[model samples]
Target: MIDPLIVLLIGFSVIGLGILLVAHLFFMDTVQKTRRGMAACAALTLLLVGLQLQHLQHLSSGADLLNSGPYAFMLCAVPAAFYLFSRDVLLPDVPLRLRDLLHLAPVLAAAFLPPNWVAVMSFVVGAGYSVWLARLVYGMRRNVGRFRFEMFFFGLFALIAVGVLALVIALPWTGAPLFYRAYAAAIGVSVALVISVLLIYPQILTDIHEAARLAYANSTLKGVDVEGRLEALNSLMTRDKLYCNENLSLALLAEAMNLSAHQLSELINSRFGVSFPRYIRELRVAEAKAILSRDQRSSALSVGMMCGFGSQSAFYAAFREVTGESPAAFRKKQPTA
Candidate 1:
C-alpha cells in the first residue's frame, strides 16, 4: 500500500485484530479449541498491520526473515484461520487432529511462499477460504432451523463470504484505474464492516426470531439423537428469546450455543441440503401452516401474519411459493382443528 492507504490498512488491521480478540474471549467457547486458529489470525493481522505501517513509513526491509522475508506471508492465516474457526465452532464432534491440520494448512503452505509470492498465496488462501465459507453457508442456508448454532453461524459466515468475494473481485481489477481501485477497496472494507456488525457482534443481537427460525426449520437431524439436540436447542431458543431479536445473527447464535459459526454452518449443510435462510423460512412457513390448521382465531389472521412472516405480503408470497397454494385458498380447504 501507499502512504495513506498503508495507515488505513494498518488501522483496519488493528480493528480486525480487535474484532478477532473479542470473538476469542466470547465467541471461541463452543469450539474451545479454535482459540489457536483465532490466535493465528490475530497474530497474522497484527503482523500485517505492522508491515503495512512500515510500508507507509517507507522503511526498507531488513535481512531478518521476519522483517523482509516471507514471515509476513503468514498473514494468510487470518482468512484461513477464520475459515477453520467456522469449522471448529460448528462441528464439535469432529476430532481436532483432522480439523487442526486443515486450519493450520495455510500457515504451513506459506512457509514455501517467497516474498513475491506472498500476495499470490494471500489471495489464493484468503479467497479460497472465502469460497469455502460461501459454499458452506449457501449450501446450508436451508438448514438454519436445524440448530441454533448452525443458523447463527451461517448468518455470520455469510458476511465472510461477501467480504472474501469483495476482496477477490476488487483486487484483480485494481489495474483499471486509480479511482476504481479506491472505490473497490472502500466498498470491500465497508461490506466487511457491515458483516462484522451483523455477524460477529455481541450475543444480545442473536434473538428470538433467529432461534424460532432455527427451531422450526430444523430437520437436519436424521433418525438419531440429532433431533433431540435440535429440540433441546429449540427449547433454549424460546427460553432465550432468540426469535424476537431482529439483530440476532450467526456469530451471536454460535456463541450462544457454544459453537463457532463455521462449524454450525457445516453441520446444517452436511445434515441437510439447504442454506441458512431457507431453513429458517421452512420453520416460518411450517409454523404458519400449523397456525392456519388449528386456530379459528387465525382465520382472520392471514397465513403470513399468523406465523413469523414480517408482512402479510411476504407471508402470502412465501406460503404460495413454498406450498404452491395461495394463503387464502389453502386456508379455505383446511378445517379449523
Candidate 2:
C-alpha cells in the first residue's frame, strides 16, 4: 500500500503545479516577462517533485538518479529562477544586463560536481538566494502598504523558502531521498497557502505588480498640489460617488484629478497609505455598508453593483474582508430604521 504521507505530498505538488500553470496562462499577456520566468520556476519545481514521487511510489529508480548530475543541476536552478522572477518584480527599473546571468553560475557547477558536492553547493546557492530574497522584500517595507494584501503571504513564502534552504543544508544527513520528500512537501504547502490568498483576493497579483512599479519608479508628483488633489479626490469619491462607476480605474481617476497615473498612485500611497485599488475598494465597501444598513429592501446584488463592485463575488469578498462579516449577515444584524 502507498504511504499516506507520500500520497498527500504528491497530491499537493500536482495541484500546486496545475494552479501555477493556469495562473501563468491567465496572466501571461499582462506581465509577460515576469510571469514567464515564474512559470518556468514552477515547472522546474514540479519536475523535481514528480520525479521524487515516482521514486517514492515505484522504488525502481534508486537514489543514484535522484542525486545525478542533471537532476542536481535542475534542483540548483529553482532558487535562481525564483530570484530572477522576484528581481524583475521588485527592481524592474534595473534592466537585466548580461552580468545578471551570473546568478545561474552555480547550476553549471552543480551539473558536473560529485554527488556529495552537489548537495553542499545547492545549499550554499539556495542560502544566498534566500538571503537576497529577504533583502529585496525587506527593502520594500517602506512601501509595504502598496502591496499590503500580499505582504503576509510573501512573508509566508519566505518562511517556506527558509525551511527548504534548511532542508538543503541537512541533505547529507537526511539523505537525498528524504530531502527530496521534504522539499516537495514544502512546495505543496506553499502553493496551497498562495491559492487560499488568491481565492480571497483575486486581484492581488495585479495590484502588487502595479504597486511595485509605482514603489520603484521615480516620483511624478513633483511641483504638484498634493492637498488640492486630495480634496478633489475626496469630492469625487464622497459627493459624486465616483467610485460607483464600474469602469473607474487608476488612469481614469488620475485624469480626473489632473494627475498622471504614477502621480496619483504615489499620492494615494503617501497620503492614504494604501494602493489605488484598495482605496477604491474601501470606499466601495463603506458605501456598501451604508446601503446594507439604510436600504433594507435593496438586494445585495444590486447594492454591490451600485457600490461599484464588478461582480457579486467580488463585492462579497471585499465586504467580508473589510467588515469581517458576509453581506447577508451584516445586513441581518442592522436594525431597520
TM-score of 1: 0.44
TM-score of each: 0.44, 0.82
Quick one: how many clashes does candidate 2 have? 0
Please give the RMSD of candidate 1 to the true structure.
10.8
Model 1 gets an lDDT of 0.50
User: What are the per-model numbers of colliding residue pairs?
Assistant: 31, 0
Model 2 residue runs over 4 Å out of place are 27-63, 146-155, 255-258
**Regions more than 4 Å wrong, model 1:** 27-41, 44-51, 54-67, 98-113, 145-196, 199-337
Per-residue lDDT over 202-225 for candidate 2, one digit per residue giving the tens place of the 0 to 100 score? 666555665676666788888998
* Candidate RMSDs in order: 10.8, 3.5
Error of 1 at 216 (Å): 16
